[model samples]
Target: MLLALLALAAWRAWVWWEAREPADHAPAADVRIEALNDRISALRGDLRAQAQRIQQADATNRVLRDELLGMGQRAALIEDSIARWSDPDRHGAQALRLDEAELLLAMGQQRLLIAGDLDGARRAYTLAGGVLSGVDDPAFLSLRQVLVQERAALDELGDDPRVRALARLQAFTSELDRPTDAVPVASAPADASWWRRAFSTVFDIQPRHRSLAVRPADRGDAMAGLQLELTLARAAAERRDVEAWRTALTRADAWLQRLWAPSPELQGRRDALAALAALPLSPELATLGSTLEQLRQLRSVRQEP
Candidate 1:
C-alpha cells in the first residue's frame, strides 16, 4: 500500500513538471511553436518588402542613366549641326539644323514622358521653343517660330493639343524643304509701264535656269520678295538702302506689292503728252490720246495660284 501511494505521488509530480515545461507539453508545445513560426514569417515578409523596394530603386536608376546617355548623344549631334546653322548664309543649313533641333527636342520630351517626368518634359519643350524661335533661317523660320510659340503656349497651359500640333508642324517642315525646279514666269512686256518695263525685263529674262533647290512652284521667293519690299517701303524715306530696295520692289511679283512712286519716265511721258494735247490742232496730240486709249486695254493682270 505505501509503495503504491509513493508511485502515485511521483506520477503526479512528473505530470505537473511536464505541464510547466513547453517541450514536455503536447498540445501546448504545438501552440507555442506555431506562435514562433508566425513571428518568423512576419519578419520574412518585411525583408521581402525591403528587397523589392531596393530592386525598384535600382531599376529607376538604370532608366535615368539610359535617358542621360541618349541626351548626351543628342547634344553632340546638335553641336555638330549648329556649326552650319549659325553661319546664317549657308543655303539650306539653317533649315537642316533647326529640323535636327526639333527632332532632338521631341526625343528628349518623349524620354521625359516615358519616365513619368511630365514637368521635366514640359520644360525641355519650352527650351526648344526658345532655341528655335530666334533661328535666322529665312524660308521656314517665321512659320516655325509661330508654331513653336503656339506649342509653348499650349504646353504651358497643360493643354493636350500640343503634341499633335507639334507632330503636324514637323511633318510640314519636312515637306516644305523638299527639292523642286525653277521655271520662268512670263508677263507681257508691252503691258508694262515704262519703269515696269525696265524692272520686269529682269524677271522675263532670268536665264530661265533652275538651280538645285529652285522650283517652278517656289513662289516662296516671290512671296519673300514681296514681303521684303513692303518692309523696305515702310521705312523707305528713312532708309540708307532705298536705291537697292526700290530697284528690288519694282520687279517683285508685281501683283503682291504695288509701286509707291510713279516712274520718272512715265511722269515725263505724261508731261509731254499734256503739252502735245495743248497744241490746238497737233496731229501728235490726237495720236497720243488714241495710243493711251488703246494701251489701257492691255493693263497687267494676275493669274490665281
Candidate 2:
C-alpha cells in the first residue's frame, strides 16, 4: 500500500511538470512560428520571380523561333534563284537575250536587203551586238567577232547608193520644174528697113536637123511621158532591179532630149541620170548573214538531243 501511494505521487508530479514546460516554451514557439511564416512568404516571392523569368524565357524563345523561320524562307528563295541561274538548258534569262539578239539580227538583214535602209540596218545590228555581248558563253564569242566584222563592213560602205540615186533624181525633178529662160533670137537692128523686117516676119527659117521646138499642146504630152519614165526608174530602183533601172533611165534620157533644147544644164542632168543608172542597188556584203547563221547553228547544236 505504501509503494502504490508513492508511485501515484510520482505520476502526478510528472504530469504537472509536463504541463508547466509547455507554458514556459509558449513564447519561443510563437517566435519560431513567426519566423517560419516569414520564410514561407520569402519562398513564395522567390517562386513568383522564377515563374516570371520562365515566362520571359518562353517569350524570347518564341521571338528567336520566328526570326529563324524568316531566315529559312530567305535561304530557300536564294537557293531557288541560284538553281534557276545555273540551269544548263539556257531556258532562263540567257535564252531570252539570245532570242532578242536573233530577232534584231533578222530585222537588220531585212532592213539592209529589202528596205535598202543602211542606217536602220546599222542601228539594228548595233543593238543586236549589244544584246549578244551580254552572253557569257565562250561558244558565242566567235559570233560576236563576226558581228563586229559585219558592222565594220557596213562602215566601209559609207553611204547607200540607192539613197544617193534618189537624191539625184529629186534634184533633177526640181530643175525640170523650173521655168526655162527664153533664148533671144537674132533680129535686125531697131532702125532696120521695113522691107527687111517684113521679109524676116514672112519667112522664118530654122534648121531641120536641130531640135524642133515642141508645140505647147505637144509639150504637155512630152512632159507626161518624161514623168512616167522617171516614175518607172524610181520603181525599178526601189525594186532593186538593176536592168530595169538602167532601161527606164535610158528611156527618160530619150524623153528629155525630145522635150528640152540642148543646154549646159540639160547635158549635166543627162550625165547625172547616166550616173544614177550605173549605181549598184545592192552592195555586195561577204559577211552579211554570217553572225545570224552562226548563231542559228550554235543554237541548233545546243538544242539537239
Candidate 3:
C-alpha cells in the first residue's frame, strides 16, 4: 500500500511540474515519462518471471514431499517385517512343536473318521499331546486339553462292549488252525466168548458197524463252520443283538471245542468268548461324537495370527 501511494504521489508531482513549466521543457518531460514507463514495464516482467519461478518451486516441493512420504511408508513396512521375523515366539522349537501337533491332530482325525481305527487314532492323539506339551500359549493349552479329552473318548469307544465283542469274534477266527480233538470210540468186549465173535464175523452183522462209528471232526468243515459262526457273531454285535451274539458265540465255541483239544489256550479263548457274550448289546460311544472335528477346528483357529 505504501509503495503504491508513493508512486502515485510522485507521478502527480511530475505531471504538475511538467504542466507549470514552459513549452521548452515539454520535450524533456515527455522523454522522462517514456523512460519511467519503460522502467515500470521491465519491473512488471521481472515480477512475472519471479511469480513463475515461485510456482515451479512450489510444484517441486510438493513432489518431493510426496516422495518422502512414500519412502517413510516403505521404511515402516520394512521395520515391521524385521520385527516379525526376529520375534522369538514365531520360530525355533515352539514353531516346530506347533507344526508337529497340527500334523498329528490331522492324522488322528483321519484315522478316527476315515479308517475307524481307534488304536491308530489314540497313537496319533498321544503323539500330538507329546508335541504340544512344550507349548505354553493359551491356544496350545486348550488344544492339549482337547487332545486329552479326545484321546480318552477314543479309548472309551474302543472299550465299548459292542466293539469289544466284535474284536473278540474276529480274533476267534484265528483259533481254527489248532488240531481237532480225537473222537472217543467204544471197543467191543475182549472177554466175549470166541463163538459169539466167530458167529458175528460169519454173519457180517456186528454189535457196531465200522463205517457208522463216530469220527473226528473234519478240519475244513470245522473251520468253515467256525468262520460262519464268527461272522454271525460279528453281525449280531453290529446289530446290537444280545441273545443273537450269545448264541453265535456259543455255537462258535462248540465248533472250537470240536476242533481243539481241552487246554489252557482253548480254555482262555472260551473264557474270552464267554466274557464278550456277557457284555451289553448296546454300548455308548462316550463323549466321542464330533471330538475330532472340534479339535481340527481349534487347530485351524489357533494357526491364525
Give all candidates' CA lDDT scores.
0.47, 0.83, 0.70
Q: What's the TM-score of each model vs. the native? A: 0.24, 0.56, 0.38
lDDT of 3 by residue, 16-35 (tens): 88878868788998999999
**Candidate 3: global Cα-lDDT?**
0.70
Candidate 1 lDDT over residue span 8-98, tens digit each: 9999999988776865567887888999999999999999999999999999999999999999999988986776455443435544555
How many backbone clashes does every candidate have? 3, 0, 0
Give the better candidate number (1 or 2) by TM-score.
Answer: 2
lDDT (0-100) at residue 127 of candidate 3?
A: 82
Give, for candidate 3, the lowest lDDT window spanning 10 residues. 205-214
Instruction: Give, for candidate 2, the lowest lDDT window spanning 10 residues.
Output: 179-188
Candidate 1 residue-wise lDDT at 122: 55
For candidate 2, write residues 40-139 as lDDT tens digits.
9999999999999999999999999999999999999898777756766467777999999999999999989888788998999999999998999898
| Candidate 1: worst-modelled 10 consecutive residues by lDDT | 280-289
Ranking by TM-score: 2, 3, 1
Which model is ahead, 2 or 3, in terms of TM-score? 2
